[model samples]
Target: MAFGDIVQGSLQDFVNIDRFDTELCVFIHIPKTAGSSLSTELDRMRPPYHNIHRKYFYGDTVTFSRIEDEIAAVIDSGALADARSCSGHFSWTLAAPIRAARPDARAFTFLRDPVKRVISDYRYSRTPTHPTYKETIERFPTIESYIEAPETQDKMARFLMPGDVRTPHEIDTFISTNYAFVGLLEMYPLSFNILSLLLGHDRMPSEHKRKTENTVDNAVDETPRLRAMIAECNQRDTVLYDIVRHKLLTVRDDWRAMREQSRPAA
Candidate 1:
C-alpha cells in the first residue's frame, strides 16, 4: 500500500482547532521512523496556548482534502491563539499546500538510515491491513532478496519520488531549502535537543527520549549478498546519509565547544 491509505475517518474537523501561540512546527513524517511515538510526546509537551494538530495524508492530490478544509475551518473559528502547529505524514508536495494555507508556518522533517528504514517498512507492510505487503513479499524470497530485485527498486523509486516522478530534485531541494530542521533519526537525542532549542521549547521528557524497538528482526551482518544489495539499494540514501551525518557531527562538535566555553572557571 502507498503512504496515504492508513489514515481513517474525516480528520478535517478534528484538526481545525485555532488557538496557537508556539511557532508552527511541522513534522514531515517519513514512514516507520518513530513518528507516532514522537508525535505523541509532542502533543503532551505542546504549550497550552498553542494549537497543535497531527494529520496524515491520504493521496497525491495537491488540493485540500476534507482534512485541509477542517484546518481552514478551525483557523476561521479563531480557536488558535497565534498560529497552528501541524505535524503528520505528508509528501513533500504538501509543503506548498501548507504554505498556501498557512503562510507563517515553518516545516521540519526527520529521516532514517534508508536500509534500516526499508527493513522496518517491510515488516510493517506485512500486516494484513497493509494493502501492498502481500504482493511485495510474495515476489521475493527474503527481505534482502526484495531489496536486490529491480521491481523493488522501481517500487521504492515511485513511493519516494520526493515531489513526483518528474521532479527528481524535489525532495532534496525541499530538505535543503524549506525545512527549518531536518533531524537524523539515528541521532535522535541530539536531534530532539536541537529541535527543542531551535523552537525555544524546554527539553523533551526522558520517556520520549529513548529510541523505539526495531520493527524488523533482521540480523546486521556484512555478508557478500547483503553488502551488494545494500550498496545498490542504498546509493541515493548513502549520499543523503553522509551529508546529514556530517551535519550532525558538526552540530555536536559545536555544541560541545559551546558547553566547554560556558563552564565556570576552575
Candidate 2:
C-alpha cells in the first residue's frame, strides 16, 4: 500500500509542543511501547485525575477479548464527567465515545520500532508474570510460531484502525487527525520531554525507565528469516513509525537550533 508524506500534527511548533487547550486530554496507550510507564506518569500529572481503563498489563482470554471494548461502556454510563484524562488499550474506534463526550479533548500516543516491539511482546508474554502466560506457552512455543499467528500482525496499526485506515497512507492521515502528539520509545527521554511540554508538567523520574532485559527463554532460535516475516506483517506500522520519527527529527533539529541560539556567547 502507498504511504503518505509526514504531514505535521496541529499541536507542535519550533521551540515548544503546544499543550492541549481543553480540560480533558486522552492517551491511546499502545502496547509494548513503554506505555505502562508513560501511563503511570500521565496519571500522576493530569489536573484532577487520569482515568485508567483495564489497568492490568496482561489478562486471561476473557480480559484480552474485552480489554479494548470495556472503555466504551464506562464512557456511555456517564463515567467521564469526573475524568480529567482517559487512557487505555482500546482500539482507535472505541475512542469515539470519549471524543463524543468531550469534543475538545486532545489525544496522543507513543510509538516504537515495530520489529523490536513485536519481539519484546513475544518475550514478555512467555513468562508467568502476566495473566496470559499459560495461554501463550501452550499455543505458541517459539518466536517464529508467534509471528505466524494472525493475532500477532501489525498490532500497532490495528490499535489505530477499523476506519478506512487499511493502507499506509490512511495510517499517517489518521494519526495526524486523531492525535495531538506522537512520541517514540527509542528516544524515551526526549519523547517525554515533548510530553512535558504538552502537559506543562515536570519530566518523569528515571525509575520508570523501561526494562531492557529479555528474561524469557521460549527455547527456539530466531533467525533473519523470522525477523523478516515479522517485518512483513507490520508494513503499515513501519510506515507509521517512520512518519512520526521523521517529524520528530524536525522537532529535534529546531529545538537544538533554538537552544544554541539562546546560549550565552564568550
lDDT of 1 at 101: 55
Q: Could you tell me how far off, in angstroms, the CA of residue 31 lies in candidate 1 after the best superposition?
A: 1.1
Query: What lDDT does candidate 2 reach at residue 237?
Result: 79
Taking all chains together, each candidate's TM-score versus the true structure is 0.63, 0.81
Write candidate 2's Cα lDDT for 195-216 as tens digits.
6656765464454746644554
lDDT of each: 0.52, 0.69
Model 1 C-alpha lDDT versus the unseen true structure: 0.52
| Residue pairs in collision within model 2 | none
